[model samples]
Target: MEKISSENPSIEKTKFIKSKGLKDKPHNYCPGCGHGIVHRLVAEVVEELGIREKVIAVAPVGCAVFAYDYWNFDVTEAPHGRPPAVATGIKRILPENFVFTYQGDGDLAAIGAAELIHAANRSENITIIFVNNTVYGMTSGQMAPTTLLGQKTLTTPHGREVLRDGYPIKVCELISVLDGARYVARGSVTTPKNVLTTKSYIKKAFLNQIENKGFSIVEILSMCPAGLDMEPLETMEWVDKELIKYFPLGVVKDV
Candidate 1:
C-alpha cells in the first residue's frame, strides 16, 4: 500500500486546492457543525462562478456572525434578522455586483421574517443562504422559529407544544408563494448526496440572481450536534429519520 505522507513522492504529486473565496484558516464552528460545510459550498460556488472578486456577502447575527473572517471576499455584518433588508440595499446600490446573505433559522424565520418577506416581495436581485438547524445554536440551544414540533431545546425542556409554540415555520414554502420570489428550495447536509444537492441549490440561487430572475433562497437543513446534545452521528440520523419528515427536500419553486 502507498503511504500518504508529505515525504512520499506520490503525496508531492497531489494537489490540495482551497477555494479562492475562502481564507486559509481554522473556523470556530463546533465539531460536526454544518456551518463549515455550508461555508465551503458557498465559497466554492462563488469561486467557480468567477464572481469572487465582485461578490458581496452579508453576515447574520447568529453563530456565523464571524463569517466575514472565513470568507476571502467582502463581507458586511447586519443586525439580527436584518440581513435581507441590508442585502437588498447593497444589491440595489451595486447592481453590477453579486450579493448574498448567510443567515441562520432564528435570524431568517423569526426576527428577520419581515425583512425576508418584503425583500422577496419586491423581487430583490440577491441570493439567500438560509441554514436551519432547528435551534439557536449560539444562544445555548433555544427554540428557534424553525424548531420542529415536539423538539426539545434549552427553552423547551419538555419538547415543544403545537398549541403553545405553534408549528415550525417553513421558509421556502412561505417565500415561494411570493410572485417576486423567482426561486426557492430546501436541501440538507445529512448525507454526501444531500450535500452535493444542497450545493447545486445554492449555485442555482446565485445563477438566478445573475440572470435578474428575482429573489432566490436555498434553505439548508443542517445538523447542530452540540446544540442538540447529541453525538454528531446521532444528530445526522435524527435529521434524516425525523426532521426531514416535516421539511422534506427539493425545489419548492423556480420561475
Candidate 2:
C-alpha cells in the first residue's frame, strides 16, 4: 500500500477515510464539468464540519449519477427529478443526521419541478446543491429548462426560440420567492475566486441545515463544454456573458 501523506491532507484522507464513510473511486463526470468541483466542496464541508459519519447525500440521476462513489458519506440514489422527495424521506426518518441532495438542472428544474418546489415550500430540512449547466448532458445535449434563449443544442439546432421554448427558468429566483426557504444563492465554479465563494455558500447551506433553518438551495452556474460546443476557456466567457445574463449571480433571497 502507498503511504499516506500528512501534509496537505484532503477530506478523503483526514475525515472520510478515517470515519469509514465513503468508498474509493474516481469521479466519472466529464472534464471541465463543475460537478466534480461541487462534489469536492461538499466532501470538504462534511469533513470540516466533522459530520462525515452523520451526513447522508441523496444522489440524483443525470450526470451526477455516481455521486455515491465520490462522497464519503451515506448516499442513496434517487430517481430522476426526485432527489428532494428522497432527501425529505431520509431527513424525516433520521432527523439527527445531515441530509443533502445533489441534483442537476435537468433533474431539478424539469421533471422534478414539483418535488423541488414542494420540498422548499414545506421547509424541508435538507440542503440542496443545484447544478445548472443549462443542458441535458446525460440525455445527449438536449435543451433543458434552464437553457438560455438562442442557444443551440441538439434539440434546438437552429437555437432555442423564445416563443416556442419559452424563457429560461431562474431557479434561485423562483425558489427565493417561496416562503419556506431560509437561504437561496446562485454561484459558479468557473474561476478560483468563484470556486472559493461557491464553497462558502455551500458550507453556509450545510450550516443552515444543521441549524434546522428550513430548505436551502445553492444554484450553481456551471459549464458544459461538451454540450455547449465551445472550448473550455471559451465556455467561461459564455457563462459570464450569456449564462449570467439570464441567471445573474449572488443570493437571490435569505430568510
**Model number with the top lDDT:** 1
- Candidate 1 achieves a global lDDT of 0.92
Give TM per candidate. Answer: 0.93, 0.90
Model 1 superposed RMSD (Cα): 4.3
Task: Please write out the lDDT profile of model 1 over residues 18-54, one tens digit for every residue.
Answer: 8888898899999999999999999999988999889
What is the Å distance of residue 216 in model 1 from its true position? 0.3
Off by over 4 Å in 2: 1-24
Per-residue alpha-carbon lDDT of candidate 2 for residues 1-255, written as tens digits (9 for 90 to 100): 135543445734643333233346766666777777777777777877889879888888898888777766788999999999999999999999999999999999999999999999999999999999999988778999998888899999999998899999988888888999899999998887798899899989999999888999999998888878787789888887778877877888877
Clashes of 1: 0
